[model samples]
Target: MRQLGGTELKRLHRSWRRKDSFRLALLLEDVQSPFNVGSIMRTAAALSVSELFVSGRTAAPGSPKAQKTALGTGRYLTWSTHEDVATAVRAARADGYHVVGLELADEAEPLAAMDLRRDVCLLIGNEDRGLSASALGLCDAVGYVPQTGRVGSLNVAVATGVACYEVRRQAWADAPAVDSGDAE
Candidate 1:
């Protein structure tokens, strides 16, 4: 119930860094909101995503709003921008990653059921339009976060956070247990 002191928090951060095991990337295609982009950057860093690929009209990580929302986390993430989404997807695929689109298309599967154990490049689309038809076609798979509430969807940033968490959850579940080296 007590707030963690700076020293304790630093130790916790270092411990988390040592346990980083997932190889995940993010591709934001034409996401217009700087706030959303920044928020996504923070979430990506927290989840240990290896990189971010921004394409089309998505806000750059250096944008003021993005920087503000990222709270200094933007510098910790490796990000690149492309003039087109296809180029980014192709590059990710060439690098031995599965490019999955986070969209709500009719053919999309539920996020919880998707296999994310392998290296992943998650493609996130615009706040309003979702993924472009061409972008969706390039993805190896499309997944949507299941929702039962009155709201049909979540904010783009919120959805990205949820998706990232799902990936991390799956990785953690599949990872083999290791000893911490502390004596009982």
Candidate 2:
């Protein structure tokens, strides 16, 4: 099998487009690491998330370390800073998006089981504390990635990637099939 070269890969990416406009927003609360912010930006851009909102003490997208890790992807993403998590959550809800928190809480449902077909504002918290109590209270629902490994939790960036993928997966599954015209 042959691998696609840079030009071909770029062309492939240009040709790919989402069939449905699934509004997926990411809310980062008090995530201090610039590297993590950048990494999450990359993941969000790659998955075509509609917007990113960084709140509280989360690192800004303009941070040097974050920009370095983002490798220019941050420039292409729609992101903004909010005064606090509550305001961000309120804005998302006001805009008709379902605010869901990505945290391992007793009330959280498995990520795979949640119906992600609606517009979602996924709330991810700080590296150490996860979502704050107030943040959790604001979420319409909470979801957690089920893990069986020795480690009880995943890094925030990794968890964001997984959750984004799940959202996209469900969107694709719900989308009507289109014929590409390939035939024998």
Candidate 3:
């Protein structure tokens, strides 16, 4: 495959930068590790996430550890700090987003098979505890990244990337097909 030039890549990245667009929001709850927070922020930025809402005792994006891991991506991504996850969920839902929690629950659907529709808000929880009952209750649906390895699950940041990519992939796939109307 051909590689994109620097200008082409910049244009592609800039295509999704809509300040007022409510495409998707990322909800981070009670995440303790700064490195994980930073890594998620980097992924969020690259994916053109509309906003990031961090709640509970999650590490702030301005911290040194976050800066080190995020490598300046946080500077481009818009984020807000919330005191609680419910408030974040409420605000996002009120804005017409379908809140989906990324967790491995008994009833959770696998990411690969999920058909995400409309605008979505991705909820990522603490590493050790996952989503609290109250927080999970607010989700429209729960999703999991299927794994075959002995390790039960993936790190939060890694899992977040997989989930985010799936959402993007599905949305792109469902988009109106383009017809060049020319011979291949």
Q: Quantify all predictions' global Cα lDDT against the true fold.
A: 0.89, 0.87, 0.84
TM-score of each: 0.90, 0.91, 0.87
In the range 1-184, model 3's lDDT, one tens digit per residue, is 7777877666554543322233777999998999999999999988878788899999998899998999999888888888899999988888778999999999999977776756888999999889899899999999999999999989999999998877877776655543322212
What lDDT score is found at residue 21 in candidate 2?
53
What 10-residue stretch in candidate 1 is worst by lDDT?
Answer: 175-184
In candidate 2, what are the lDDT values of residues 1-184, reduced to their tens digit?
Answer: 7787877665554433344457888999999999999999999888887889889999998899999999999877888788999998887887788999999999999989999988998999999999999999999999999999999999999999999989877887866664432211
lDDT, model 2, position 31: 95
Total colliding residue pairs, candidate 3: 0
Best candidate (score: TM-score): 2
Model 2, residue 23: distance off in Å is: 1.1
Please give the ranking of all candidate structures by lDDT, highest first, separated by commas.
1, 2, 3
Rank all candidate structures by their TM-score, best first, as comma-separated numbers. Answer: 2, 1, 3
- RMSD (CA, Å), each prediction: 2.5, 2.7, 4.0
Runs in model 1 deviating more than 4 A are 13-20, 176-184
